[model samples]
Target: MATFNLKTVAALLFLILSGCATYQTKVNDARNAIASENPEQAVALLKPLAEEESRDQLVYLLDYATALQQARKFKESAQAYQKAAQIAEVQDYYSVSKITASLVLTEEMAQYKGDDYEKVLINAMNAVNYLEMGNLDEALVEVKQLNLKLYKYRTEAKKNYEQNPYAYYLGAMIWEAQRSFDDAYIAYKNVYDIDPNYGPIKADLLRSARLAQRPDELSKWQKQFGESAPSVDLKNSGEVVLIFEQGWGPRKESRPENRRFPQLKPVYARTQRAKLEVANQSATTNEIFSVERVAIKTLNDDYARLVGSRVAGIGAKAVLADQVRQKNELLGAVAWIALNATDRADVRQWSTLPESFQIARMTLKPGKYKVKAIGLDAYGSESGEQMPEREIEVRAGKKVFVSWRSVR
Candidate 1:
């Protein structure tokens, strides 16, 4: 009887040892599979162990969650992570245990829905709570880790859109926030087509798609979405104020003869006729004029005549002087120019003029003109006669304002 009892006891001990060896081997294999980045293999190895009676339930759950995450099974991975977290809480393990749990939950929440959609939503809510509590970095870390999981969820949800059409809509929002507009557009469109009762999202998707064709339209849509349109400031006076910057010098004479002749003489003799001929020529023809050292005779002409005559390249220079003298007459006068809505974009054309002037104000047509000061020696005779260019546009009955700055 004693010998029989010893044999039974030894056999039972041997069986128990063998079972432990098998469990340890399987656990080690699963770990190795995970190390190799083969989540599918790890899962295949660990699932049976997780179900076994001898293995630690918490260890099984944690490994399973890690494997699912690696395999891009976000929903399942999230559930497993939650279970591991619960186990950790039950065991009172805080640091790495809680952190890992929170990270998985956050990522799952950010992802599109899957079979574990409810869990994902819960975790996402928790993540938001954590973020609100000033643990943003940790919450973000969770979001980062779940990228692959979310991608898998998106792919799966797309394949079965009828099961949850809302997934595509949510995906679109995620993509839009990330600035992936193209993908977002498609996703939103899908949601609109599949589910008409999606409330404002359908209209929003259509609007976004239309506005994407033009930037201006996009701005309008954005304003409408925000429930605030930009205010347009309209001036009732129909007058534009021209503020001039000081510090422009007169055109320097190219030669001594430039100083000898009256500034009006050379301009009347040469420049005006040349410009008229050039203006009359066919647009296709390209003519080049060589400007050697040229001189101006004088600066004395009404605005109309000054604008008309092109002598001595003096038409532009004459216009510049007239503008200065007119401004000086006003004594701290400012030039006002009338502009139409179309004129705003063209106002920069005035900058092409010589250094003697700057644009001050802009208004639509039907405006008046007020000029300021023309200082002495404001006009110069030099080798290079730097004349300011005129950029003022005037319509019938509308006034434009301009100011002159003397060149030192």
Candidate 2:
């Protein structure tokens, strides 16, 4: 009996360690492909690992969806993210009985119930993808779904602090595009309520207020911001908006401790914004804007809140292990030591996500324009890699949208 038990434990440990090693190698390889600007290769490499049967399904699905979006496969990207969102919703109702497994197994062995912020962002990405594909109806549906999810979260948290300003900003854009000025005004007001100093929010608030004919609100904002508020000539003019995303987001890794289970920590890299320049190809209209992006959902805050629950579970596991050791010294000691070494926290994340999302909205005549974005470090030194200069055409009385990502 002792021999069989020992062998079982050995097999379980080997399986856990080997599986993590194998998955981590694949993750690194896909990251390399993305760094090389070969999103097609990244998608191919991540697809197999993103299967429903995989242990890290949620993490890989997010990676695969991002790669697809980078490749401009917006429809496919939306579908992939939709799958991840479905999985997240299903896990919401997962039974409390699953806690029993924590006595013997770490969080790494359980199915991933995605972080709340991740769930909301998944829908936001889907909405953006639909808009990119020129499906306004689908995009509106996704925006509504995002609102529903946000409301659900707010209700569950029993506080209003968890509201997402970016999501509200996006909702305002969709509504404004549809000429639903009242709805757009409400959404923009929500953003302003959350962050009054946000660059684009002030401009959006002004536009919506003007369209909705709320002179009182418009006067209030105009008085508050004066000439510093971002504005555009909406009458008899077209606009080009650039939604820029900066370097890679946070990643997850385990920090091991003596005689205690490893803890998962989010690792963020140091990155700086690059100077961006825009010019008109048809005429001499040059513009420059400094990079300014705010955190809509802070991962550090999420991790800080999660630590309490994790500590409780881990503490209970330690107590149980010590009790087992009291009964059989040698076996219990071996088991306790083994769990200490092998039981690690799950360290998977949406590795390709951007650290921040920013907007550069400009009003221009109906003509072609060229824009370039460069990467910079904290010391204001250039990284020598400039995003390919993009040429965009603006139509009369219509909006032009462009997006660029820098992950250095």
Q: List the residue pairs that clash in candidate 2.
A: none
TM-score of 2: 0.82
Quote the lDDT for 233 in model 2: 56
In terms of TM-score, the best-performing candidate is 2
Worst 10 residues of 2 by lDDT: 282-291
Positional deviation of residue 55's Cα in model 2 after best superposition, in angstroms: 4.1
The Cα error of candidate 2 at residue 297, in Å, is 8.3
* lDDT tens readout by residue for model 1, 1-408: 556545644553443344333223445666556545465898887677455633155446555655654455655665666654454334323455433322322111111111222223223322322332334344434443333334544695442212233335434444443445676676666655665554455345544455344456446546655643322222332323232322311222212443212121111111111010111221110111101111111122122342232242233334433564464532112111110100110000001011221222233444333323222222321212112443443454223333222222
Clashes of each: 43, 0
Q: Which structure among the candidates has the greatest lDDT?
A: 2
**Structural similarity to truth (TM-score) of each candidate:** 0.23, 0.82
RMSD of each: 39.8, 4.6
